[model samples]
Target chain A: MDYFRQAWAIAWKDILSELRTRQMISSVLLFCLLVMVIFSFTFDPGAEYVSELVPGILWVAFCFAGTLGLERSWGAEQENRAVDGLLLSPMDRSAIFLGKALGNLVFMLAVELVTFPLAAVLFGVSFLDVWGKVALVAVLATAGFMAVGTLLSAITVNTKLREILLPILLFPILVPVILAAVKSTGSLLQGEGWEGISSWVKLLAAFDVIFITVAILTFEYVVEE
Target chain B: MEPSLRRNLLGLATFMMIEAAIFMIFIWAPTEQVMGIVQRIFYFHVSCGMTTFLAFFIVFLASILYLWKKDKKWDIVAHASAELGVLFCTLVLLSGPIWARPIWGTWWTWDARLTTSLVLWLIYVAYLMLRSASRGSERRTRFAAVFGIVGFVDVPLVYLSIHWWRTIHPVVIKPSGIGLAPPMLYTFLVSWAAITILYFYLLGLRIRIGKLSEGVEELKAIQYSGV
Candidate 1:
């Protein structure tokens, strides 16, 4: 209970700060919008094939924007040396990881909330009928992405390349998440129902569980002085 | 034994093994009725693949040890192993396409094994880049170790996801294990043994280079400190 409270407190700190400024969220949202616009230009928006392309475009937007936001996730901590202070406090390092990952998930979900509907509007493909299923896949896949992203964010924060190194280190490990998410989303958009996506859903869930557990175990080593 | 003498013996043994493997692969092994001469690439290609996995497994183990013990030696081993892993993985990637062009009729297909190997190659290549980008700090060592662990842990997941993804698409070639005849089997074993020794030899050489560079850095530090 105490651990959960501590983790929540850390997460709340990020939320409070973002609420005050709204810098990272706004930029990430704009980037997501831009991705959709650019991708739309590549294909005829009214073409029959547009539905098949919608899921891939939406995910590409989310991933690129998520990468942008995650790059900033650790920026403030590193700049202010706040991470060292957090380390000095009487909290478990794994708590810090959980808290940061939670904060990232919430921020990413906020961006996706707008990006999804806007994508549907711009691409002229309505997934409103299957909105629930799409959202579930989005959250599951994003959870897995954050689980790994937050840890890699921490690792890359210490590197000389900084933000440049995060995606290079991140995307390869993220192959499974991207594959499962895109495939499931593509199927869901086609109205294949749960039967079509069950295996992929299971893959996403397994990836989330495995990575979150691994990140928790390895987080301490990344943050140790 | 003296270090130089040991290295010489390793070199000699590796040389002999390579000679034997070449003879067995080209002469001793009978030509396949189907793949014919092109099948010969299979021995070296498979051997390189095995070595790549072994090298990565070493990187994973050494990385865990480095983090647990906080030893510089283990860090050096991990770094060296990752570099060698990338080398062997590149060989696998290169050889796959070369063999595939004539056999599979295309230079590349999204086959399960092929896709998995490509993902693995990208992951370790990133690992190498991370090491180079963050060169000197102890913090860099810890960061690399963390990635090393995460990258390795993701491999099975990558393979599983790609395998499923491939099944959904039309598979150009059904990936099946080749049943090697007796001579082909002996040839493969010898080639595999040769490549494994080559991996060890390169690992040792790279580790020594790593140690020497560390020594040079220490000497430079002492000179600057004017103690």
Candidate 2:
């Protein structure tokens, strides 16, 4: 119970920081909107291609936006030296992972909230048809990406080339996650019945479980000096 | 294991010569009842592909052992094997397109084998980058081990690709499967044995060099630290 409270406290710290500054929100929102606009230039908005490309384009934007937010979370921690203070606290280190991951999830979801609806408008896709499945895919994928990214961010925090290194290390492991997410979302959008999306859901769920467990266990060594 | 001194003496250079001879023999070795000299590529191409799989398997084993023991020696073995695996896999990729060009009538297709090889290449490229990017010795070793273990996921995916997708590559030798002709089968088995020896010899030499370098570094550190 206390662990949950500690995790919540850390998460709330991030939320309050974002609320005060709006740094994460504005950049991610603007970046996602820009990606969508750039994509619109190349691919026609009125054609049937919108339905086909919406899932891929939205996920790509979310992925890039998520990276932006994640970098801010750690970057802010570095500037304030808050991670050292947090590490000095009595709470379990894994809780730090859970806290930051939950915090990242919230920020990403907030950005996605705007990106998804706006994408629907710009791309001429119906949000009413398969919004549930789309949301489910986002949740699973976001969790998996955050779990691995949190671990890699800590690992690379001390490195010279961290900004570039984190994504290179994170992307290959998360390939399976991204592939499964894109496939499942495309199926849902194409109106393939629930059965078609089930396998990919399983893939994403399995990846999330494996990665989250491994990250929690190994994170101690990552943060240790 | 007893050192196979005599066996190791017959290195990959010798076996490769034999492989080349057998390959040329395909032109003079007589045409098959069905597929012609074009079919001869089956021997070298398939054997190289199998040897690459064997190298990667060694990498996976060495990686697991390195993590378990926390020993630098195992890390060297893993790193060397992975480099060799990439080399063999690259050969398989190159030779593949040439054969496919004539037979499949295109340079490349999105076949299971081709996609699997490309993904496998990308994963190890990431692995090499991870090792290179780390600063400290211990840090690089640990990161390499983790990447090595995770990278094995691509290995199984590559091996089972034909079954998972209807690959254009033939699945000639399944364990519970049918047999092959005497001439082609005999030459292939011989070549496989030769290539296996070559992989071990190369891996052993690389590991030895790595240990020597580590030793020199340790001596230099002690000399400078005044310990």
Candidate 3:
């Protein structure tokens, strides 16, 4: 109960600050919107290519935008030296990781909420029909992304070339998450329903579980001096 | 065995084995009825692929040991293993295309093995970059050890997730596996053994060099400080 409370407290700390400033989500949403618009040119509405390209565009937008958000989130912590205070708090380190990851997930999902509709408009597709499945896929994929990204963001926050290093360190281990997400998104966009995408969902879920566990267990070492 | 003598023996043994393997490969292994001379690239290509995995597996074990013991030696081993893994993975990525351009008739395809290996290669390259980025801080080793462990864990998941799809790439080892003809199978085994020796030799040399450099740096620091 106390563990949950501490995790919630840490998450609340992020959420409250985010609500006040609005910087992280705004930049992420705007960047994603830009990517969607530029990519939509190739995706010409109602073209045979648009349907095929939508999945790739959507995921690339999210992952790229998500990297920006992750950098900001961890960067703020590192720059302010707040992580040291958190480390010294005598709280459970895993709780700290969970809290931060949860905060990242929420912010990413909020950005995705705005990005999806804008994507539909630019690409001239009606997401109303499959928004639920799309949302499900996005949520699962986002969890995997944030789980790994949050951990790596911390890992790289103290590095010499963190901006470039973050994506380099991230995108490779993230290949599976991106693959499953893109595959599942392709299926959802095709209107194939759950049966067509179950394997990918399982892969995403498995990746989420594996990565979250690894991240939490290893978070201590990553954050420790 | 004495260190230099063992190394000399290893050097001689590696040369003899590689010589024999090369002979078996070029002479003993029969040409395939289908792909012909170009198919022989499979001998070294697949060997590099298998050894890449072995190198990464050592990295995984060494990484865990590094984290558990917090010993710098384990960190060195993990770093060395990752370095060799990346080297061999590059070989896999390179030789793959050479073999594929002739066989698959294209420079590349998004086949599962190829894609997974590409990701694996990228992950370790990132690992090496992270190691390089970690300078003059205790955090460097700890950060790298954790990253190494996580990267190692990701390799199999990357393989399985990517392989979950219907890949056009041939599944060489299948459910009804071990389908190699006698000569091809023997050539593969010999190549695998020779490469394994080469891998250990490289790993040993890298670790020794790492320790020597660490000593040199320590001496330099001491000389400068007049301690």
State the C-alpha lDDT per candidate.
0.89, 0.76, 0.87
Candidate 3 per-residue lDDT over residues A128-214, each given as its tens digit: 988888888899999999999999999887888888899999999888888888888888878888898888888888989999999
Query: Worst ten-residue run, lDDT, model 3 chain A?
Result: A40-49
Ranking by TM-score: 3, 1, 2
- Superior by TM-score: candidate 1 or candidate 2: 1
Chain B TM-score of every predicted model: 0.94, 0.83, 0.96
lDDT of 3 by residue, B1-227 (tens): 79979988888888888998899999999998888898888888888899999998898888889888888898889889899999999998998898789789998998888998888999899988998897564688888888888888888778888788647776666788777898899998999899889988888889999888888988998999998
Q: Candidate 2 residues B110-185, lDDT tens each?
A: 7766777767766776667777778888887776766676567434433342234346766688798645677667
Mark the 10 consecutive residues where model 1 chain A has the least summed lDDT: A119-128
Candidate 1 lDDT (Cα, whole model)? 0.89
Once superposed on the true structure, which residue ranges of model 3 sit more than 4 Å away at CA?
A43-46
Candidates 1 and 3: which is better by DockQ?
1
Q: Model 2, A41-155: lDDT tens per residue?
A: 8876588667888888888887777776777778788887887998999999989889998898888888887888898788887767888888888899899889878777776
Report per-candidate DockQ.
Answer: 0.82, 0.34, 0.80
lDDT of 3: 0.87
The predicted structure with the larger lDDT, 2 or 3, is 3
